[model samples]
Target: MPSETQLAYFLQQLLNAAPLSALYAMLAFGYSLSFALTKRADFTPGALFAFAGQVFVYFTAFGYDRLWLVYPAALALGVAASLAYTMLASTLTGSKVIRPLSQMSPNSVITASLAIMIVLMELVRIAANTRDLWLSPFLNQRITFWDHPGFPVVMTQIQIMNALAMAAIVFAAAYILQRSRQGRNWRAVSDDPFAAALLGIDPGRVIVFAGLTTAAFSAISGIMATAYYGSMDFGAGLMFGLKVVMIAAIGDQSSPARSAAGAALFGLAETFWGAYMPYVWRDLAMFSTLVVLAVVMRQERRV
Candidate 1:
Protein backbone atom coordinates (compact mmCIF):
# COMPACT_ATOMS: atom_id res chain seq x y z
CA MET A 1 0.00 0.00 0.00
CA PRO A 2 1.20 3.51 -0.84
CA SER A 3 1.53 6.22 1.79
CA GLU A 4 -0.82 9.23 1.82
CA THR A 5 1.89 11.53 0.45
CA GLN A 6 2.59 9.25 -2.49
CA LEU A 7 -1.11 8.97 -3.29
CA ALA A 8 -1.56 12.72 -3.21
CA TYR A 9 1.40 13.19 -5.51
CA PHE A 10 0.05 10.65 -7.97
CA LEU A 11 -3.39 12.26 -8.05
CA GLN A 12 -1.83 15.66 -8.62
CA GLN A 13 0.17 14.31 -11.54
CA LEU A 14 -2.94 12.76 -13.07
CA LEU A 15 -4.83 16.03 -13.02
CA ASN A 16 -1.93 17.92 -14.56
CA ALA A 17 -1.30 15.32 -17.24
CA ALA A 18 -4.90 14.89 -18.44
CA PRO A 19 -5.10 17.97 -20.66
CA LEU A 20 -1.64 17.53 -22.14
CA SER A 21 -2.44 13.94 -23.01
CA ALA A 22 -5.63 14.98 -24.77
CA LEU A 23 -3.75 17.54 -26.86
CA TYR A 24 -1.16 14.96 -27.91
CA ALA A 25 -3.91 12.47 -28.81
CA MET A 26 -5.68 14.95 -31.06
CA LEU A 27 -2.45 15.99 -32.73
CA ALA A 28 -1.45 12.39 -33.29
CA PHE A 29 -4.85 11.68 -34.79
CA GLY A 30 -4.28 14.46 -37.29
CA TYR A 31 -1.02 12.82 -38.32
CA SER A 32 -2.72 9.43 -38.55
CA LEU A 33 -5.51 10.82 -40.69
CA SER A 34 -3.12 11.94 -43.38
CA PHE A 35 -0.95 8.86 -43.02
CA ALA A 36 -3.99 6.64 -43.56
CA LEU A 37 -4.26 7.90 -47.11
CA THR A 38 -0.73 8.84 -48.15
CA LYS A 39 1.16 6.32 -46.04
CA ARG A 40 3.28 9.34 -45.11
CA ALA A 41 3.07 11.56 -42.08
CA ASP A 42 1.63 14.93 -43.11
CA PHE A 43 3.74 17.82 -41.88
CA THR A 44 1.11 20.18 -43.29
CA PRO A 45 -0.82 19.91 -40.02
CA GLY A 46 1.97 21.72 -38.14
CA ALA A 47 1.39 24.82 -40.22
CA LEU A 48 -2.36 24.46 -39.99
CA PHE A 49 -2.12 24.32 -36.21
CA ALA A 50 -0.10 27.52 -36.09
CA PHE A 51 -2.21 29.15 -38.79
CA ALA A 52 -5.49 28.48 -36.99
CA GLY A 53 -4.29 29.99 -33.74
CA GLN A 54 -2.79 33.04 -35.46
CA VAL A 55 -5.93 33.63 -37.50
CA PHE A 56 -8.07 33.33 -34.39
CA VAL A 57 -5.95 35.92 -32.65
CA TYR A 58 -6.03 38.21 -35.68
CA PHE A 59 -9.82 38.09 -35.96
CA THR A 60 -10.34 38.61 -32.27
CA ALA A 61 -8.02 41.58 -32.37
CA PHE A 62 -9.92 42.88 -35.38
CA GLY A 63 -13.14 42.64 -33.39
CA TYR A 64 -11.79 45.08 -30.79
CA ASP A 65 -13.79 44.41 -27.59
CA ARG A 66 -17.04 42.66 -28.59
CA LEU A 67 -15.95 39.17 -27.55
CA TRP A 68 -19.34 37.53 -28.06
CA LEU A 69 -19.33 38.38 -31.74
CA VAL A 70 -15.58 38.20 -32.19
CA TYR A 71 -15.08 34.73 -30.79
CA PRO A 72 -17.33 33.08 -33.37
CA ALA A 73 -15.82 35.13 -36.14
CA ALA A 74 -12.36 34.12 -35.03
CA LEU A 75 -13.27 30.45 -34.87
CA ALA A 76 -14.77 30.52 -38.33
CA LEU A 77 -11.74 32.18 -39.81
CA GLY A 78 -9.41 29.71 -38.14
CA VAL A 79 -11.41 26.73 -39.37
CA ALA A 80 -11.59 28.15 -42.87
CA ALA A 81 -7.86 28.80 -43.00
CA SER A 82 -7.07 25.32 -41.76
CA LEU A 83 -9.40 23.70 -44.30
CA ALA A 84 -8.01 25.78 -47.12
CA TYR A 85 -4.40 24.87 -46.34
CA THR A 86 -5.21 21.20 -45.90
CA MET A 87 -6.97 21.13 -49.26
CA LEU A 88 -4.15 22.84 -51.06
CA ALA A 89 -1.48 20.62 -49.52
CA SER A 90 -3.49 17.46 -50.10
CA THR A 91 -4.26 18.31 -53.70
CA LEU A 92 -0.66 19.16 -54.50
CA THR A 93 0.75 16.08 -52.85
CA GLY A 94 -1.86 13.85 -54.48
CA SER A 95 -1.38 15.50 -57.85
CA LYS A 96 0.27 13.66 -60.72
CA VAL A 97 3.39 15.79 -60.30
CA ILE A 98 3.99 14.62 -56.73
CA ARG A 99 2.08 11.31 -56.66
CA PRO A 100 4.54 9.56 -58.95
CA LEU A 101 7.45 10.80 -56.88
CA SER A 102 5.73 9.68 -53.67
CA GLN A 103 5.45 6.16 -55.05
CA MET A 104 9.12 6.11 -55.96
CA SER A 105 10.37 7.66 -52.75
CA PRO A 106 8.76 8.60 -49.44
CA ASN A 107 11.30 11.41 -49.14
CA SER A 108 9.58 13.27 -51.97
CA VAL A 109 6.27 13.54 -50.14
CA ILE A 110 8.02 14.48 -46.89
CA THR A 111 9.93 17.23 -48.67
CA ALA A 112 6.75 18.64 -50.15
CA SER A 113 5.13 18.60 -46.74
CA LEU A 114 8.10 20.37 -45.18
CA ALA A 115 8.00 23.01 -47.91
CA ILE A 116 4.31 23.60 -47.33
CA MET A 117 4.84 23.86 -43.61
CA ILE A 118 7.56 26.50 -44.10
CA VAL A 119 5.39 28.51 -46.47
CA LEU A 120 2.44 28.48 -44.09
CA MET A 121 4.60 29.39 -41.15
CA GLU A 122 6.07 32.30 -43.06
CA LEU A 123 2.60 33.47 -44.01
CA VAL A 124 1.51 33.32 -40.39
CA ARG A 125 4.57 35.25 -39.28
CA ILE A 126 3.89 37.93 -41.83
CA ALA A 127 0.25 38.24 -40.83
CA ALA A 128 0.87 38.26 -37.09
CA ASN A 129 3.83 40.66 -37.36
CA THR A 130 6.31 38.03 -36.05
CA ARG A 131 5.15 38.28 -32.48
CA ASP A 132 3.29 36.35 -29.85
CA LEU A 133 -0.43 37.00 -30.22
CA TRP A 134 -2.79 37.09 -27.26
CA LEU A 135 -6.36 35.94 -26.83
CA SER A 136 -8.96 36.95 -24.25
CA PRO A 137 -8.15 35.52 -20.83
CA PHE A 138 -11.64 34.38 -20.03
CA LEU A 139 -10.77 30.67 -20.10
CA ASN A 140 -7.79 30.84 -17.80
CA GLN A 141 -9.78 30.59 -14.59
CA ARG A 142 -8.92 27.46 -12.60
CA ILE A 143 -11.35 25.25 -10.71
CA THR A 144 -9.72 23.69 -7.69
CA PHE A 145 -10.67 20.23 -6.42
CA TRP A 146 -9.42 17.28 -4.37
CA ASP A 147 -7.94 19.33 -1.61
CA HIS A 148 -5.26 17.54 0.40
CA PRO A 149 -2.62 18.54 2.89
CA GLY A 150 -0.10 20.50 0.77
CA PHE A 151 -1.50 19.02 -2.44
CA PRO A 152 -4.46 20.45 -4.30
CA VAL A 153 -5.48 19.48 -7.81
CA VAL A 154 -6.70 22.30 -9.99
CA MET A 155 -7.89 22.43 -13.59
CA THR A 156 -8.81 25.32 -15.80
CA GLN A 157 -12.19 25.48 -17.51
CA ILE A 158 -10.35 25.58 -20.82
CA GLN A 159 -8.49 22.42 -19.87
CA ILE A 160 -11.76 20.63 -19.10
CA MET A 161 -13.23 21.74 -22.41
CA ASN A 162 -10.04 20.68 -24.17
CA ALA A 163 -10.25 17.24 -22.60
CA LEU A 164 -13.89 16.85 -23.64
CA ALA A 165 -13.13 18.09 -27.15
CA MET A 166 -10.25 15.63 -27.58
CA ALA A 167 -12.46 12.74 -26.47
CA ALA A 168 -15.18 13.71 -28.94
CA ILE A 169 -12.70 14.10 -31.78
CA VAL A 170 -11.07 10.75 -31.08
CA PHE A 171 -14.43 9.01 -30.82
CA ALA A 172 -15.66 10.58 -34.02
CA ALA A 173 -12.49 9.63 -35.89
CA ALA A 174 -12.69 6.03 -34.67
CA TYR A 175 -16.38 5.82 -35.54
CA ILE A 176 -15.85 7.20 -39.01
CA LEU A 177 -12.96 4.89 -39.72
CA GLN A 178 -14.68 1.86 -38.23
CA ARG A 179 -18.31 2.22 -39.33
CA SER A 180 -18.76 4.85 -42.03
CA ARG A 181 -18.82 4.32 -45.80
CA GLN A 182 -16.44 7.15 -46.42
CA GLY A 183 -14.01 5.61 -43.98
CA ARG A 184 -14.26 2.34 -45.83
CA ASN A 185 -13.39 4.18 -48.99
CA TRP A 186 -10.42 5.78 -47.26
CA ARG A 187 -9.14 2.43 -46.07
CA ALA A 188 -9.63 0.95 -49.50
CA VAL A 189 -7.59 3.70 -51.05
CA SER A 190 -4.97 3.41 -48.36
CA ASP A 191 -4.53 -0.27 -49.04
CA ASP A 192 -4.22 0.20 -52.78
CA PRO A 193 -5.16 3.32 -54.72
CA PHE A 194 -5.08 1.61 -58.08
CA ALA A 195 -7.20 -1.23 -56.81
CA ALA A 196 -9.63 1.13 -55.08
CA ALA A 197 -9.97 3.11 -58.32
CA LEU A 198 -10.58 -0.10 -60.28
CA LEU A 199 -13.46 -0.73 -57.87
CA GLY A 200 -14.91 2.74 -58.78
CA ILE A 201 -13.67 4.69 -55.80
CA ASP A 202 -11.94 7.95 -56.60
CA PRO A 203 -8.58 7.83 -54.85
CA GLY A 204 -8.18 11.56 -55.25
CA ARG A 205 -11.48 12.26 -53.57
CA VAL A 206 -10.72 9.95 -50.67
CA ILE A 207 -7.34 11.55 -50.17
CA VAL A 208 -8.89 15.00 -50.15
CA PHE A 209 -11.51 13.92 -47.65
CA ALA A 210 -8.84 12.50 -45.38
CA GLY A 211 -6.84 15.71 -45.60
CA LEU A 212 -9.86 17.87 -44.79
CA THR A 213 -10.76 15.75 -41.80
CA THR A 214 -7.23 15.96 -40.52
CA ALA A 215 -7.29 19.73 -40.96
CA ALA A 216 -10.46 19.93 -38.92
CA PHE A 217 -8.76 18.05 -36.12
CA SER A 218 -5.74 20.35 -36.23
CA ALA A 219 -7.99 23.43 -36.24
CA ILE A 220 -9.76 22.33 -33.10
CA SER A 221 -6.43 21.53 -31.47
CA GLY A 222 -5.02 24.95 -32.31
CA ILE A 223 -8.05 26.76 -30.99
CA MET A 224 -8.02 24.82 -27.76
CA ALA A 225 -4.27 25.28 -27.32
CA THR A 226 -4.54 29.02 -27.81
CA ALA A 227 -7.40 29.23 -25.37
CA TYR A 228 -5.59 27.15 -22.80
CA TYR A 229 -2.30 29.02 -23.06
CA GLY A 230 -3.89 32.44 -23.63
CA SER A 231 -1.27 33.18 -26.28
CA MET A 232 0.14 31.89 -29.55
CA ASP A 233 3.80 32.01 -30.44
CA PHE A 234 5.33 31.62 -33.87
CA GLY A 235 7.17 28.39 -33.07
CA ALA A 236 4.48 26.70 -30.99
CA GLY A 237 2.84 24.99 -33.96
CA LEU A 238 6.11 23.69 -35.39
CA MET A 239 7.14 22.27 -32.03
CA PHE A 240 3.69 20.81 -31.53
CA GLY A 241 3.71 19.21 -34.95
CA LEU A 242 7.13 17.69 -34.34
CA LYS A 243 6.05 16.34 -30.96
CA VAL A 244 2.93 14.74 -32.45
CA VAL A 245 5.07 13.14 -35.13
CA MET A 246 7.30 11.69 -32.45
CA ILE A 247 4.29 10.44 -30.54
CA ALA A 248 2.86 8.86 -33.67
CA ALA A 249 6.18 7.30 -34.55
CA ILE A 250 6.52 5.92 -31.06
CA GLY A 251 2.97 4.55 -31.09
CA ASP A 252 2.93 3.35 -34.73
CA GLN A 253 2.09 5.81 -37.47
CA SER A 254 -0.18 3.31 -39.18
CA SER A 255 -2.49 3.06 -36.17
CA PRO A 256 -4.10 6.21 -34.79
CA ALA A 257 -5.54 4.44 -31.74
CA ARG A 258 -2.16 3.06 -30.84
CA SER A 259 -0.54 6.43 -31.44
CA ALA A 260 -3.04 8.10 -29.12
CA ALA A 261 -2.36 5.54 -26.47
CA GLY A 262 1.35 6.23 -26.81
CA ALA A 263 0.66 9.94 -26.51
CA ALA A 264 -1.24 9.40 -23.25
CA LEU A 265 1.63 7.39 -21.86
CA PHE A 266 4.09 10.04 -22.91
CA GLY A 267 1.96 12.69 -21.27
CA LEU A 268 1.90 10.76 -18.03
CA ALA A 269 5.65 10.32 -18.14
CA GLU A 270 6.15 14.01 -18.87
CA THR A 271 3.94 15.05 -15.95
CA PHE A 272 5.69 12.78 -13.51
CA TRP A 273 9.11 13.86 -14.73
CA GLY A 274 8.20 17.51 -14.43
CA ALA A 275 6.94 17.00 -10.92
CA TYR A 276 9.80 14.89 -9.68
CA MET A 277 12.81 15.73 -11.81
CA PRO A 278 14.61 18.88 -12.87
CA TYR A 279 12.86 20.85 -15.61
CA VAL A 280 15.91 20.90 -17.87
CA TRP A 281 16.11 17.11 -18.09
CA ARG A 282 12.43 16.58 -18.81
CA ASP A 283 12.57 16.88 -22.63
CA LEU A 284 15.85 14.96 -22.85
CA ALA A 285 14.36 12.07 -20.90
CA MET A 286 11.14 12.00 -22.93
CA PHE A 287 12.93 12.23 -26.27
CA SER A 288 15.45 9.57 -25.28
CA THR A 289 12.57 7.24 -24.60
CA LEU A 290 11.10 8.12 -27.97
CA VAL A 291 14.35 7.21 -29.69
CA VAL A 292 14.41 3.87 -27.93
CA LEU A 293 10.81 3.20 -28.87
CA ALA A 294 11.51 4.04 -32.48
CA VAL A 295 14.40 1.61 -32.59
CA VAL A 296 12.33 -1.12 -30.98
CA MET A 297 9.50 -0.55 -33.42
CA ARG A 298 11.90 -0.74 -36.35
CA GLN A 299 13.34 -3.99 -35.05
CA GLU A 300 9.84 -5.38 -34.59
CA ARG A 301 8.92 -4.49 -38.15
CA ARG A 302 12.02 -6.27 -39.37
CA VAL A 303 11.03 -9.37 -37.43
Candidate 2:
Protein backbone atom coordinates (compact mmCIF):
# COMPACT_ATOMS: atom_id res chain seq x y z
CA MET A 1 0.00 0.00 0.00
CA PRO A 2 1.20 3.55 -0.69
CA SER A 3 2.21 5.46 2.41
CA GLU A 4 1.17 9.00 3.32
CA THR A 5 4.75 10.12 2.77
CA GLN A 6 4.65 8.85 -0.80
CA LEU A 7 1.47 10.77 -1.48
CA ALA A 8 2.96 13.95 -0.03
CA TYR A 9 6.09 13.60 -2.10
CA PHE A 10 4.01 13.20 -5.25
CA LEU A 11 2.11 16.37 -4.41
CA GLN A 12 5.30 18.20 -3.67
CA GLN A 13 6.73 17.26 -7.06
CA LEU A 14 3.65 18.57 -8.81
CA LEU A 15 3.74 21.92 -7.00
CA ASN A 16 7.44 22.46 -7.62
CA ALA A 17 7.13 21.28 -11.21
CA ALA A 18 4.34 23.74 -12.02
CA PRO A 19 6.23 26.89 -10.98
CA LEU A 20 9.46 25.71 -12.57
CA SER A 21 7.58 24.89 -15.73
CA ALA A 22 6.05 28.36 -15.74
CA LEU A 23 9.51 29.87 -15.41
CA TYR A 24 10.69 27.79 -18.38
CA ALA A 25 7.71 28.97 -20.38
CA MET A 26 8.50 32.61 -19.65
CA LEU A 27 12.20 32.29 -20.48
CA ALA A 28 11.40 30.36 -23.64
CA PHE A 29 9.05 33.13 -24.74
CA GLY A 30 11.77 35.69 -24.12
CA TYR A 31 14.13 33.80 -26.43
CA SER A 32 11.32 33.27 -28.93
CA LEU A 33 10.79 37.00 -29.19
CA SER A 34 14.46 37.47 -29.97
CA PHE A 35 14.41 34.75 -32.62
CA ALA A 36 11.12 36.00 -33.98
CA LEU A 37 12.35 39.54 -34.44
CA THR A 38 15.90 38.88 -35.55
CA LYS A 39 15.89 35.20 -36.57
CA ARG A 40 18.77 34.39 -34.25
CA ALA A 41 19.16 33.20 -30.71
CA ASP A 42 21.21 35.30 -28.29
CA PHE A 43 23.66 32.63 -27.18
CA THR A 44 25.22 34.79 -24.49
CA PRO A 45 21.99 35.62 -22.72
CA GLY A 46 22.82 33.33 -19.80
CA ALA A 47 26.15 35.05 -19.14
CA LEU A 48 24.45 38.41 -18.92
CA PHE A 49 21.87 36.78 -16.71
CA ALA A 50 24.46 35.13 -14.48
CA PHE A 51 26.26 38.45 -14.35
CA ALA A 52 23.14 40.02 -12.90
CA GLY A 53 23.32 37.71 -9.90
CA GLN A 54 27.00 38.41 -9.56
CA VAL A 55 26.19 42.10 -9.74
CA PHE A 56 23.70 41.62 -6.95
CA VAL A 57 26.33 39.73 -5.02
CA TYR A 58 28.91 42.37 -5.80
CA PHE A 59 26.56 45.09 -4.54
CA THR A 60 25.74 43.00 -1.49
CA ALA A 61 29.43 42.36 -1.02
CA PHE A 62 29.83 46.12 -1.01
CA GLY A 63 27.00 46.25 1.57
CA TYR A 64 24.38 47.65 -0.78
CA ASP A 65 21.12 45.66 -0.73
CA ARG A 66 18.71 48.35 -1.73
CA LEU A 67 15.81 46.34 -3.19
CA TRP A 68 15.25 49.09 -5.73
CA LEU A 69 18.78 48.83 -7.06
CA VAL A 70 18.84 45.07 -7.61
CA TYR A 71 16.65 45.01 -10.73
CA PRO A 72 17.95 48.29 -12.13
CA ALA A 73 21.56 47.22 -11.90
CA ALA A 74 20.68 43.87 -13.42
CA LEU A 75 18.70 45.52 -16.22
CA ALA A 76 21.53 47.94 -16.96
CA LEU A 77 24.08 45.16 -17.28
CA GLY A 78 21.72 43.11 -19.46
CA VAL A 79 21.10 46.05 -21.78
CA ALA A 80 24.78 46.78 -22.17
CA ALA A 81 25.80 43.22 -22.90
CA SER A 82 22.84 42.41 -25.14
CA LEU A 83 23.18 45.69 -27.05
CA ALA A 84 26.79 44.91 -27.86
CA TYR A 85 25.76 41.45 -29.06
CA THR A 86 23.11 42.96 -31.32
CA MET A 87 25.47 45.48 -32.93
CA LEU A 88 28.13 42.88 -33.58
CA ALA A 89 25.61 40.44 -35.06
CA SER A 90 24.20 43.16 -37.32
CA THR A 91 27.66 43.85 -38.69
CA LEU A 92 28.13 40.17 -39.39
CA THR A 93 24.71 39.81 -41.03
CA GLY A 94 25.41 42.81 -43.25
CA SER A 95 28.58 41.13 -44.47
CA LYS A 96 27.04 37.74 -45.12
CA VAL A 97 26.48 36.88 -48.84
CA ILE A 98 23.37 34.75 -48.16
CA ARG A 99 21.32 37.79 -47.20
CA PRO A 100 21.99 39.54 -50.48
CA LEU A 101 21.65 36.33 -52.44
CA SER A 102 18.42 35.36 -50.70
CA GLN A 103 17.17 38.91 -50.45
CA MET A 104 17.66 39.17 -46.66
CA SER A 105 16.33 35.89 -45.36
CA PRO A 106 16.57 33.93 -42.07
CA ASN A 107 19.49 31.70 -43.09
CA SER A 108 22.20 34.31 -42.93
CA VAL A 109 20.66 35.98 -39.91
CA ILE A 110 20.69 32.70 -37.97
CA THR A 111 24.27 32.03 -38.98
CA ALA A 112 25.23 35.44 -37.66
CA SER A 113 23.53 34.65 -34.37
CA LEU A 114 25.54 31.43 -34.04
CA ALA A 115 28.76 33.29 -34.69
CA ILE A 116 27.80 35.97 -32.16
CA MET A 117 27.13 33.32 -29.50
CA ILE A 118 30.60 31.82 -29.93
CA VAL A 119 32.18 35.24 -29.53
CA LEU A 120 30.14 36.05 -26.44
CA MET A 121 31.13 32.79 -24.71
CA GLU A 122 34.82 33.44 -25.25
CA LEU A 123 34.48 36.99 -24.00
CA VAL A 124 32.61 35.91 -20.85
CA ARG A 125 35.34 33.39 -20.01
CA ILE A 126 37.94 36.12 -20.32
CA ALA A 127 35.98 38.69 -18.31
CA ALA A 128 34.80 36.50 -15.40
CA ASN A 129 38.17 34.76 -14.93
CA THR A 130 36.48 31.35 -14.70
CA ARG A 131 36.40 31.28 -10.95
CA ASP A 132 33.73 30.30 -8.41
CA LEU A 133 30.47 32.20 -8.92
CA TRP A 134 27.24 32.15 -6.97
CA LEU A 135 24.60 34.31 -5.28
CA SER A 136 23.10 33.97 -1.82
CA PRO A 137 19.38 34.41 -1.67
CA PHE A 138 18.53 38.05 -2.31
CA LEU A 139 15.74 37.89 0.26
CA ASN A 140 16.99 35.21 2.69
CA GLN A 141 13.32 34.52 3.23
CA ARG A 142 10.92 31.67 2.62
CA ILE A 143 7.22 31.09 2.24
CA THR A 144 5.02 28.11 3.07
CA PHE A 145 1.68 27.06 1.63
CA TRP A 146 -0.49 24.15 2.68
CA ASP A 147 -3.00 22.53 0.41
CA HIS A 148 -3.98 20.01 3.06
CA PRO A 149 -2.62 18.34 6.16
CA GLY A 150 0.85 16.96 5.42
CA PHE A 151 0.88 18.63 2.02
CA PRO A 152 2.68 21.83 2.79
CA VAL A 153 4.91 23.38 0.12
CA VAL A 154 7.91 25.60 0.79
CA MET A 155 9.45 28.22 -1.51
CA THR A 156 11.71 31.24 -1.21
CA GLN A 157 11.12 34.90 -1.77
CA ILE A 158 13.43 34.76 -4.77
CA GLN A 159 11.25 32.14 -6.44
CA ILE A 160 8.23 34.29 -5.71
CA MET A 161 10.07 37.22 -7.25
CA ASN A 162 10.86 35.10 -10.31
CA ALA A 163 7.18 34.29 -10.67
CA LEU A 164 6.26 37.95 -10.40
CA ALA A 165 8.94 39.04 -12.85
CA MET A 166 7.77 36.48 -15.40
CA ALA A 167 4.22 37.80 -15.09
CA ALA A 168 5.29 41.42 -15.57
CA ILE A 169 7.41 40.72 -18.66
CA VAL A 170 4.71 38.61 -20.30
CA PHE A 171 1.95 41.18 -19.87
CA ALA A 172 4.20 44.08 -20.80
CA ALA A 173 5.59 42.41 -23.93
CA ALA A 174 2.11 41.38 -25.11
CA TYR A 175 0.78 44.91 -24.72
CA ILE A 176 3.69 46.55 -26.52
CA LEU A 177 3.69 44.09 -29.42
CA GLN A 178 -0.02 44.48 -29.92
CA ARG A 179 -0.42 48.26 -29.55
CA SER A 180 2.64 50.14 -30.73
CA ARG A 181 3.84 51.61 -34.02
CA GLN A 182 7.27 50.17 -33.41
CA GLY A 183 5.53 46.84 -32.84
CA ARG A 184 3.83 47.11 -36.25
CA ASN A 185 7.15 47.85 -37.87
CA TRP A 186 8.66 44.87 -36.05
CA ARG A 187 5.90 42.65 -37.36
CA ALA A 188 6.46 43.95 -40.86
CA VAL A 189 10.16 43.26 -40.64
CA SER A 190 9.53 39.79 -39.25
CA ASP A 191 7.29 38.85 -42.16
CA ASP A 192 9.67 40.01 -44.88
CA PRO A 193 12.68 42.23 -44.40
CA PHE A 194 12.81 43.17 -48.07
CA ALA A 195 9.23 44.42 -48.03
CA ALA A 196 9.86 46.33 -44.84
CA ALA A 197 12.95 47.89 -46.38
CA LEU A 198 10.98 48.93 -49.51
CA LEU A 199 8.59 50.67 -47.13
CA GLY A 200 11.57 52.84 -46.16
CA ILE A 201 12.25 50.84 -43.04
CA ASP A 202 15.96 50.31 -42.54
CA PRO A 203 16.21 46.56 -42.16
CA GLY A 204 19.61 46.96 -40.54
CA ARG A 205 18.24 49.03 -37.68
CA VAL A 206 15.26 46.72 -37.35
CA ILE A 207 17.45 43.62 -37.04
CA VAL A 208 19.78 45.32 -34.57
CA PHE A 209 16.91 46.64 -32.49
CA ALA A 210 15.22 43.29 -32.56
CA GLY A 211 18.42 41.55 -31.49
CA LEU A 212 18.94 44.17 -28.80
CA THR A 213 15.43 43.76 -27.45
CA THR A 214 15.72 39.98 -27.40
CA ALA A 215 19.15 40.13 -25.79
CA ALA A 216 17.73 42.39 -23.14
CA PHE A 217 15.03 39.85 -22.36
CA SER A 218 17.55 37.00 -22.46
CA ALA A 219 19.55 38.90 -19.85
CA ILE A 220 16.46 39.05 -17.70
CA SER A 221 16.14 35.27 -18.03
CA GLY A 222 19.78 34.78 -17.02
CA ILE A 223 19.51 37.06 -14.02
CA MET A 224 16.31 35.42 -12.92
CA ALA A 225 17.82 31.95 -13.29
CA THR A 226 21.03 32.85 -11.47
CA ALA A 227 19.46 34.99 -8.77
CA TYR A 228 16.90 32.34 -8.12
CA TYR A 229 19.33 29.41 -8.14
CA GLY A 230 22.67 31.16 -7.51
CA SER A 231 25.81 31.11 -9.65
CA MET A 232 26.35 29.90 -13.23
CA ASP A 233 29.31 29.31 -15.50
CA PHE A 234 30.12 31.32 -18.61
CA GLY A 235 29.40 28.14 -20.56
CA ALA A 236 26.07 27.63 -18.78
CA GLY A 237 24.32 29.68 -21.41
CA LEU A 238 24.86 27.06 -24.10
CA MET A 239 22.55 24.44 -22.64
CA PHE A 240 20.01 26.99 -21.50
CA GLY A 241 20.20 28.90 -24.77
CA LEU A 242 19.86 25.74 -26.81
CA LYS A 243 16.92 24.71 -24.70
CA VAL A 244 15.28 28.00 -25.62
CA VAL A 245 16.09 27.37 -29.25
CA MET A 246 14.58 23.90 -29.11
CA ILE A 247 11.45 25.27 -27.53
CA ALA A 248 11.18 27.88 -30.25
CA ALA A 249 11.83 25.31 -32.93
CA ILE A 250 9.21 22.97 -31.49
CA GLY A 251 6.72 25.78 -31.65
CA ASP A 252 7.66 26.07 -35.36
CA GLN A 253 8.48 29.71 -34.61
CA SER A 254 4.93 30.57 -35.57
CA SER A 255 3.26 31.74 -32.34
CA PRO A 256 5.29 33.21 -29.51
CA ALA A 257 2.71 32.21 -26.92
CA ARG A 258 2.71 28.64 -28.20
CA SER A 259 6.48 28.75 -27.98
CA ALA A 260 6.09 29.62 -24.33
CA ALA A 261 3.84 26.63 -23.89
CA GLY A 262 6.45 24.46 -25.58
CA ALA A 263 9.01 25.78 -23.13
CA ALA A 264 6.89 24.84 -20.15
CA LEU A 265 6.23 21.44 -21.61
CA PHE A 266 9.90 20.91 -22.29
CA GLY A 267 10.79 21.90 -18.77
CA LEU A 268 8.22 19.57 -17.29
CA ALA A 269 9.33 16.74 -19.50
CA GLU A 270 12.97 17.31 -18.67
CA THR A 271 12.32 17.49 -14.95
CA PHE A 272 10.07 14.48 -14.81
CA TRP A 273 12.13 12.33 -17.15
CA GLY A 274 15.37 13.19 -15.40
CA ALA A 275 13.92 11.93 -12.17
CA TYR A 276 12.43 8.69 -13.42
CA MET A 277 15.14 7.70 -15.87
CA PRO A 278 18.79 6.84 -15.31
CA TYR A 279 21.26 9.69 -15.18
CA VAL A 280 23.36 8.36 -18.07
CA TRP A 281 20.45 8.09 -20.47
CA ARG A 282 18.63 11.19 -19.19
CA ASP A 283 19.41 13.43 -22.13
CA LEU A 284 18.90 10.61 -24.61
CA ALA A 285 15.24 10.57 -23.71
CA MET A 286 14.79 14.34 -23.61
CA PHE A 287 16.54 15.07 -26.87
CA SER A 288 15.00 12.11 -28.61
CA THR A 289 11.64 13.68 -27.96
CA LEU A 290 12.90 16.85 -29.59
CA VAL A 291 14.15 14.83 -32.55
CA VAL A 292 10.79 13.17 -33.05
CA LEU A 293 9.00 16.48 -32.70
CA ALA A 294 11.32 17.98 -35.28
CA VAL A 295 10.78 15.19 -37.81
CA VAL A 296 7.02 15.32 -37.48
CA MET A 297 6.96 19.09 -37.60
CA ARG A 298 9.19 19.20 -40.66
CA GLN A 299 6.88 16.87 -42.51
CA GLU A 300 3.94 19.01 -41.49
CA ARG A 301 5.84 22.10 -42.55
CA ARG A 302 6.33 20.65 -45.99
CA VAL A 303 2.64 19.90 -46.30
Q: Which stretches of model 1 miss by more than 4 angstroms?
A: 1-5, 65-106
* Alpha-carbon TM-score of each model against the true structure: 0.86, 0.75
The per-prediction tally of clashing pairs is 0, 2
Candidate 2: stretches off by over 4 Å: 1-7, 37-115, 147-151, 197-202
Per-residue CA lDDT of candidate 2, range 1-303, in tens? Answer: 246756766656655566567666766666666566555544444434444444433443333243444654654544454445444444454445324633556555455445555565565556546555455445648677645455556667777777677757766776787789877877788888799989998877765565556556665665566666666565655566666667667875645677777877787777776656786887777778887896787688799
Worst 10 residues of 1 by lDDT: 89-98
TM-score between model 2 and native? 0.75
User: For model 1, which pairs clash?
Assistant: none
* Lowest lDDT block of 10, candidate 2: 55-64
